[model samples]
Target: MISISDDVKVVENFVRVAQIIANLESILTQAKNLSLTAKNARVVALRAGDAALGFKPITNFIDEFSEQTIASTTKIADLSNQLFKVAHKLVRCSQYFHQMTLLKTHINSKQADAMYQEALKSQRRAASQLSLALSELENHFEDIQKQMQSAEYIAVTSRVEATNAGDFSDSLQSVSDFIASAAKTIKTAVVYNLSEIHTLRGVLK
Candidate 1:
C-alpha cells in the first residue's frame, strides 16, 4: 500500500523534526542571556535596602529557574538530535523500499512479491521504533511544560514584588517582563514541537 507520495510525506515530517531541533539552539541562547540579565537584576535589588526585601526571593527564584531552563533545554536539544537522526534514517529506508517495489512491479515474478513483502515487514519494524522515539520526544517536551510552569510562578511573583520595591520598581519590573517573555518563548516552542511530533507519528503510521 506504500506509495511514493507516502514516502515523501514521511520525509517531510523528518525535516520538520530537524527544524524543531534547529529552533532549540536559538531558544537556549536566549535563555542564557535572560539568566545573565536576572543575575544583574538581583544585584540591583540587593542594593535597594529594606524597601526591596521582597525582591530577594523573586530574584533568587528567577536565578534558579534560569539555571534549570538551560539544563533542560540542553537535554531537549540532545533528544531532538537523536530524533532527527532516526527519522531521517527511516526516510531512506522507506525510499529504498519504494524502489524495490518498482522493480517488483516490472518483473511480475512470484519471488519478487515475497522479497518485497519481507522488506516491507522490516520497514514497518524500523518505522515503529522511530515512532517510539517521537513519543519519547513528546514526553520530554511535557517535562518542559512543567519547568515553564515553575518559571511562570517566579515571573508572576517578581512582578508583584517589584511593584512595591520603590525607586528600582521600574527596573525590576522590566527584568520580570523580560523573564516572562523568555518563558513564553519556551512555552511556544514546546507546544509547536509536540504538535510536530504528533504529525510525524501519524506520517509513519
Candidate 2:
C-alpha cells in the first residue's frame, strides 16, 4: 500500500496541473485581447498609408500568434484534465492494496500471497498506463512552452516595429502601444505561470 504522503502527492500533482490549466485560461484571455488590439492596429496602419506600412506585417503576425496561443493554451488545458482523471483512476486502483493489506491477517498464508500477487500485478498495470499518459502530458507541456515563447517573440517584435514607425501617424502609434502592452501582458502572465507549469512537469517526472 502507498503511504498517505504518496496519496497526497497524487492530489498535489493533480492540483498542480489544474493550476496550469487556470493560468493558461488567463493567457487565453490575454491572447484574445491582443487579437482584438491587433485588429484595431490594422485599421490604424491602413490609415497611416506608406508611413506605417511596416506595421501591417506586425499586425498580421500578432493576430496569428494570438490565435495559435489561444488554441495551444486550450489544448493543453484539456490534456491536463485528462491526465488528472487518469491519474485519479490509478490512485483508486492502488488503494485496493491498502484494503487487502487490512484483511491480510484473516486470510490463510497461501491465499494472502495469491491476493498480494494479484494486487501487485494490477497495480503494476495501472502504473504502466499512468506512465504512458504522463509522457503524453509532458509532450503537451513542451508544446505549450514553445507556443508561449513564440507568442512572446511576436509581441516584442510587433512593439518594436510599431515604435520604429513613430511620428508617422499618432493614431497608429497609439494602437501600436496598445498591441505592445497586450503582448507585455501576455508575457507577464506566462512568466508567473510557466514556473508552475515546469514544476508540475517536474512532479510528473
Candidate 3:
C-alpha cells in the first residue's frame, strides 16, 4: 500500500512537470512570433531606401534578439526532453505497482480498485497534457510556414523593385543587388522552415 501511494505521488509530479513543459512551449511560440515580426520590419525598412535611415539599428537589434530567442528555445527544448524522460520513468513505476496490486486482488479488492482508479486518472491527465503540448507545437509550425511564405513574397518583391529601378553602369553592381535580395529571402525562409521542422520533430519524439 505504501508503494502504491508513492507511485501515485510520482505520477502527480510527472503531470506537474508536463504542464511546465507545455508552458515553456507556449513561450517558444511567442518568441517565434517576435522573430517573424522583427524580420518583417527589417524587410520593410530595407525596401524604404535611404529615407529609412534608422533601419540599420532596428535590423541589428532584431538580429541580436532573434539569436537570443533561438538560444532560449533550444534550452527549453532540452528541458522538455528531460521532463519527458522523467514521465516515462514514472509510467513504468506505476505499471509495476499496478501489477503488484493485481497479484493480491482477492485479499485487497477494494484497495486495489482505489489504486487502479488513481493510476488511471494520472494516465488520463498525462495524456491530456501531451495532447495540448502537441497542439501548441503544431501551431508553432504553422506560424513558421506563414513566415516562410511571407519572406518568399518579400524577396520576390525586392527583386522586382531592384529591376525596375533601372540598369546599373556596372553589371557587377546589378548582379550584387540581385544576389543580396535573393539571399535575404532565402535566409529568412530557410530559418523559418528549419526551426519549424526541428520543433515538429521534437514534438513527435
Instruction: Return the TM-score for each candidate structure.
Output: 0.84, 0.74, 0.43
Off by over 4 Å in 3: 1-108, 164-205
lDDT of 1 by residue, 1-205 (tens): 5676966786687689777887787668767877798788888888887878898877777777677777877888887887777777777677778877987989899888887887787788778878777777777778777877887887898889888889989988888888888888888888887788777877766
| Evaluation by lDDT, superior candidate among 2 and 3 | 2
Local error of candidate 2 at residue 152 (angstroms): 3.5
Candidate 2 lDDT tens digits, 5-120: 77787888777667767776777887788788779888878776777777898788778877887777777677767767766766666677656666675676878878877776
Candidates arranged by lDDT, highest first:
1, 2, 3
Residue 119 error, candidate 2, Å: 2.6
TM-score for candidate 1: 0.84
User: How much does each candidate deviate from the true structure in C-alpha RMSD?
Assistant: 2.9, 3.7, 9.7
Error of 3 at 38 (Å): 9.3
lDDT score at residue 200, model 3, on the 0-100 scale: 36
Which of 1 and 3 is ahead in TM-score? 1
What is the alpha-carbon lDDT for the whole of candidate 3?
0.49
Q: Relative to the unseen true structure, what is the C-alpha lDDT of residue 124 in candidate 1, on a scale of 0 to 100?
A: 87
lDDT of 1 at 183: 82
> What's the distance in Å from true for residue 156, model 2?
3.8
Per-residue C-alpha lDDT of model 3 across residues 124-181, encoded as one tens digit per residue? 6655555555455445444534543444444344444434333321322233243344
Count clashing residue pairs per candidate. 0, 0, 0
